[model samples]
Target: MQTITLDALIPREDFNILSSTGSSSNTRNKQTLSIEDLKYDSFFFSALRKPIFQRETNEWDAEKVCSMIESFVNDELVPAIILWRNQGGYIFVIDGAHRLSSLGAWINDDYGDGPISISFYGNYISDEQRKAAEKTRQLVNQKIGSFKEIEAISRNRISTENDLKNDIAKNLGALAIQLQWVDGNAAKAEDSFLKINQSATKISEAELELIKNREHSYAIAARAIVRAGKGYKYWSAYSITEQEHIVELSKKIHQLMFGIGNINMDDINSLPIGGPLNSSLTLDVVTQTVRICNGLDRKTKTNVGDANEVITYLRNTLRILQYINSKEKFSLGVHPFVYFYSGIGKHKIGSYYGFLMFAKELIEKKKIDNFIQVRSRFESVIYQYNFLVQQIIRKDRQSKRAYVSIKDYYVLLMEIILENPTYSNEAIVEEIKKNDKFKYLQTEIVDNETVAVKSNFSRGKKQQIKMETFVESLPRCPICGGYICSNSVSVDHIQRKQDGGTNAVENGQITHLYCNTTYKN
Candidate 1:
């Protein structure tokens, strides 16, 4: 990973713009700065820090960042860049890390989508993020032009190309941004960051919680995993050997979740575990890890009170996910049910949490073997009844019931698997209706109309139809229980035909031909 000095990243302007000349104490009272001040004031730029709790750079898209620049050029109601003064004369960004970073990115040409962000965050950006950045770069370029292009124009204005310079002067040159400084000490600064960010931030509550818990092993591991070891080194304080372990395990999980795209960007063909590559899934994965390993109740908040325990939990969580994704061990067919699936259709966080809870139950209750034994049959049901399965997942997912609702459904899934019966869609729906927790969800409507709208059931049915093409596109295999690469599958008699078994539906089973002849025979 490359570490860059602030000076190396900072761009210099042609004119020498110094900090306000006054008594040091008196100058400290000024709480505002213009774009020119940000550009010229060495101390102002030098003292800026994107707080630890601040979001990753990629959280804001290029267009959003560019909008801020556009707003600056347009001189609109741009918000103040909140700052906190340190013990010396240093400054820390409290509530405007994204705004500040965007300006810095524009100045430094390090829009979290490119090699600059990769290098800045120690070379850990995902392909998804790089693509996003590339798009941002295009948008920024198309909308506002690159910094170099504008700078060149700015430079040439003093020479013969005065017309071009004058045309862009307002858009590129003559604008100022307001800065607001927080009063009090470092604690107050942190408090201000939290309070101000509560309303201004785009980060979710769970993600903020993870940022707040950064010191914990799970948080560090999650940060490492989410960025695919491309972001800031949260585990830097550990011993080199421990750091290696963290890196190795995090890489293993990262690859399992995201593939080796960070290492070999070109080979990335399939979507990652978190569809569309939402970094917030890292928080969910971390939370589930801690909750499962510690055997904590689902309703309780997962915390960082125990670092060692958290590390162990993450390891266990990685192990389970690895097993689920493994080709050899417990090949779960169509296991995307475990993660959020927002491709052509809608899937929810409940799908992600539900899988975690299911895995936890399997691990804790020593039901792995039972799950494996019935896995083939269970997967058949899930494959055939994909619509109802998603409907059940969606019904419970409303009002943020992912963490709780998944467990209820997982229990139902286990029961269905254990019973070894042909579960019709109606039967499944009936069972879901009987579920005390799902009763209210059974007859719910999910629209924002003034009066009662169509039921969520109707919506899910339509969604289910939309999803049919996708589901049919998936390779169906009952033996190995995943997408089949083989051109043909063998249907064999459960009771051998030689034993006078009738050709009944109950007597037929699907299996890989290799399994039917080579193994079963």
Candidate 2:
């Protein structure tokens, strides 16, 4: 074996006065590369192996990888791959994908267009299928080639790979190979790998996941949650952003439940089965439930085979919180309901759950110390739970509205909370006032001191304003901007119907017929 350039198999410097006395040996026609230095017996798999990215491979992808390698071996060019060394002893693939992929295929026994060697599968063939198999071999002999002839046919390979188990053992005995293999530091290797792959440009989910990592902030823990869930990929695949939301949510859940600054999957796996599946309030409930469980040092317990118990508690909690958020529908910002996701981080479940502790203390008041025990007892866990809570809430809210994208909403909420945690209602009102949607809010009461109009309410008959006049007077729909069909002059509940909304003037809103339909949906 020797390191050499592709231009010349035997580099002039390493060229030797070789003996080619055998009649069958070719002195001038043998394929040899210009080698800088040669060690004829040094060629081995370990010398060519490089650690890149420690990719976690499952059966499905493992199958695909084997197939990919088989395909590569059939072709001539070898594209580079990125490799990295993970905590695991295995070498991570960074680059030279085509080459190493072929290697994997060889190891997997997916060679010569057939899969072999690997175990875990049951019986290789059944008596019932033997006839079909025999027929296939007979056809290969007549149409393609005899198994022996096919085995000996000139292989279309630039790089040859084989093992003792393969039928091509005889061919391996006669082959001579000349090539160069280069390895570099893992980080630099990946950079080079990326440069090589940049040309081919296949965008992969793994890459997208890495992109979301943002230099591996708390995001790494979050990504880990999603990664674990990939084992259950039967669920819809979320976009990179939504995936991050799930991760962030996991982080929040860990934070709040145990006041844990980090997230742990062991805690998350305790949530109910349908918890992650639900896109609605189920996520929020699951998050809180997981937090509560983590708060109890549940992570240390090995008996948590199922999260059903904790999930049920979570549902109860959501049922309670829903009533509260419903009564005081506070819009943290645009898209009203989205406002609450940030609140999870604003205060722990204990803080909000204090309303209960209050009653327990003295029918209406829980002391600050009692609240602290509820909160600070699991301070680290609390952050984890809150992280999960906000994450689910984020995904739910984000899916409904792209108006305020995830990044924008997250940044804005964080900024506002950090800048002024105790922003007065008046201050919130002022900010609310700044929204373009609120500009149309009714001005004020008609003053009793007004010179002419003295009636407290419209009296006697309806003020006979003309249909055209009223039509011209009304504002356009703030939502859809169609003519607020003055014909249907009654106000509409701006919030919505299913939410137990009503058509009272205060609760109602002015909107054109067409716009109302759009808004209703």
Candidate 3:
């Protein structure tokens, strides 16, 4: 990802131009400034944030400024303020982040003494130096402090020392608290913040997802589900984005079906198991969970208990492992599983599994890139797997002893993964050739036998034995239970009249040709 240019990202310049005398020269003087102009200093704040400041931002204490700005940003009663320009585009505060975001609950009453009665707590300081700094702040705030230089910045933004309160509520629109430092400057600030602020930690995407939880109740519910569960973190999942994708998938499915504004906790029970969570193969577990939790006999009204959570989590985990460790030919390694499972609902289950496995093997064996191969192979396998699955489903529906040829297995043999993933004709024959049943059923071409046996790399074209006809029935004719179906079942040319069959019961009596000829002699 390339950095967005500052000029490109934030364009409209409607702020007072900086005069040479270190003051804002109000340029828009066509008419007297309205109360709207003074009501909130949007232009003034904008002027305070000119990009010129970002040029030499590193020379200043960015951490201290960012921290102070964070404070002003948090306080609600405080109006939009800026760290205004000096000469040129030297910038400062744009607006109160806290106040603009609506962080104040209420202003103090007039009868509550001259000072505003507000509830506020200072930083989570944990050192003597910080304590002394707090002491300095108190001294300045009480007008008896040594560090009076920051008195202007420290005047409680809201009034009772509270012009603004910085908690969770503030007029975010009026306060629109955006730090207008340059991208490069922001990077510098970030680097400095990391170096100087030893205790301050940056927000991670996981924590960010948690913080932004309220924005999307669907995500909130998914995060809550993961949080509520124990002994399982999404660390094993493909990626954080993939984990988020699962939540989004469920949210999308619900939105698509019911047009629900958000995912309902009760209705979420209907989600496809692992359908939302698994990063590879099928979301069988997700579907199953939704099925079990929402199915008629289930009881979602009683909050999904601990048992269900563990069962569901483990079920999905094991299913994913199964999807990974499937088929002797290939393994769907960690990386590709994440990539392929994103839009797998549109592909055939077996094909998805096979393609993932093939891609993983391809990455390791062929030394290919996982990202590109995943997408490219995914497209390739869709139609092939789709056809393979269609053939399987069709056979399954027909309820016949589905006969598949070994010649046909290569198409779907990327891997024989999943719970009974239907095999193609060639795959079935290969599987049967590997089978110990009817040892004579194989063609031992390489081994110099009539029938051959399968090799290690059956999926790849290596020298091999191929299975001929399906010899699923018993050795003897199942009906008569007397003669071997293998040889006794000779083609008794139906046109017996054409041959000089003596018109006698003995000649007419049907039997194995070998049995009949010897008996006549």
Candidate 4:
């Protein structure tokens, strides 16, 4: 197998290319330019006040970039580069930012990891994006060679040096292919972008919404936080101090979700921020969660309030999420089944967002402490009945129905925890079965075809053995006969030490403090 790294793909002519094309900020006054004209560094891509939406740069994978570069070099009939001139007279690319950036990356020898790309996106290009550029460069070199090599190859094709030079001049020099300049103000330019991109491939609905209302606070906060301030800073419109806070807050939120720690452990039962599934789901969830939490109807229909005000709410919201996963509080931190993962081996986007919706409810009601008090019991009930939750989630998966069903579980869980601070797993299960929506899950259990359901949560006895292997894994509380989590729990002698019980691991078990201290005492 072949491996590609960032350094392996660097062209020997990178410095020579940079040296040959000395700095010149000459604007492209002409509407048409050929592939050959792009070799120079003079054509500045400063068209719009912001050429590309901040969150969306280098989103194209290597194959797409490489294919685009090859298409341009082969002189294929490609789409026109849409241009719009700003008040500063800078020619900005309205629709072809990624296309132009791909070509520019080729000419400049800067595939995001390069110094030029570092400066381009303000040093926020992510590792995933940088690797993508590297892979693309490798593909481009394998297929079409570097820009200088392509120039040399074009020259080499002819036996006569003069003839080769003539070929380069005639074919490569003819930069005029196609260009469409949109004459308009910023709003008009944005509208053109939205209309043009509706037909373009690879633009998700979430991305389209963000592009359409890039100025909205939900959009701004989501973009800033999604990539951990490692992409274009959408919060650039805010004051410098506000921008700093946005970056800081975004970093914290990013860490909370994806940080390498206890929450993201190798153990399958670990608390989940996310898992390896849809790469784009993070941005979508964060952006939508912002709108959901802040009560924004839609990017177009709703006013997202002031940028600073949105940032303030987002920061607090993120902090609340962070608090739930904090190690110091109830060590349960986050329960994977409740928040991010279904009991089945699938990453549940519904579970993630549904839990956040629940968190938003908690924050709104100022019930963080109250929730914290019963978190152990809540986790216990859910853990013991993991198969039931998995059954509900697996039925819908990523559809709209999945979100509603999972949210129904969240609502019921919250209500039960609120009404009965110390509830039994059987009670919670009974409560869930009473709900009309969960009636189907109960029917599966009553039919005794739980083989499918059991396989999801435990894969049968193997999972039971795995669960038993973990030293910290405790059984249900003996006194209350409820599920137990590692929070406000007591280690008691199975047969009280006073009654001749030893403090051996086999002789000990975990129970809730109330059960051990009040009842067992």
- Listed per model in order, the count of residue pairs whose N, CA or C atoms clash below 3 Å is 2, 66, 58, 7
Would you list the C-alpha lDDT of every candidate in the order shown?
0.55, 0.30, 0.28, 0.58
lDDT of 1 at 105: 66
Task: Compute the lDDT of residue 517 as modeled in candidate 4.
Answer: 52
- Under the 3 Å rule for N, CA and C atoms, how many clashes does model 3 have? 58
All candidates: TM-score: 0.73, 0.26, 0.20, 0.66
Which candidate do you rate higher for lDDT, 1 or 3? 1
lDDT of 2 at 260: 17
Report the poorest 10 consecutive residues by lDDT, candidate 3.
105-114
Tell me the spans in candidate 1 whose CA falls farther than 4 Å from its real position.
1-43, 158-165, 169-174, 260-269, 278-290, 297-307, 327-334, 337-343, 380-401, 428-467, 478-521
In model 1, the worst 10-residue window by lDDT is 7-16
Candidate with top TM-score is 1
**Per-residue lDDT of 213 in model 3:** 28
lDDT of 2: 0.30
Tens digits of per-residue lDDT for model 1 on 1-521? 11112211322111112244322242445556655545423556765556655554445555577797667655677787777655555566676666666676666666654445555556566555556556666776777667667776667654324444345554555666777778776667777777787776555766676666666655666666655544456666667776667667667666666553332211112434443344434455545544554455435665553435535755876766654453333333234532345323433555655666677677678676566555555555445544444566666545655555666665676576567456664565466667676565343334566786566657655655655554455554444454432223566687888899889999887654444554455
- Candidate with the greatest lDDT versus the true structure: 4
Q: Tens digits of per-residue lDDT for model 3 on 392-417?
A: 43444343212122112322333332
lDDT of 4 by residue, 115-192 (tens): 755654465555555655677778877776677665665656543344433443346655455888787566786677
Across residues 1-521, which tens digit of lDDT does each residue of candidate 2 receive?
00000101111110011222322221232232111112212332322233212222211222333344333333324343333322222233344434443343333223212222111112222221233224333433333233233244434333224332143323433433334222444345455545555565443433433332322322222223322222212112445654444434443343222221122222321222212221222223333333332332113332322233323333333333222222112100011111221221122222332222222232123232232222211222222223333333344443532212322322333334344546643353344335453333232335565576656534212322232243345354554332322223324577776888776667877543323443244
Candidate 3 C-alpha error for residue 435, in Å: 22
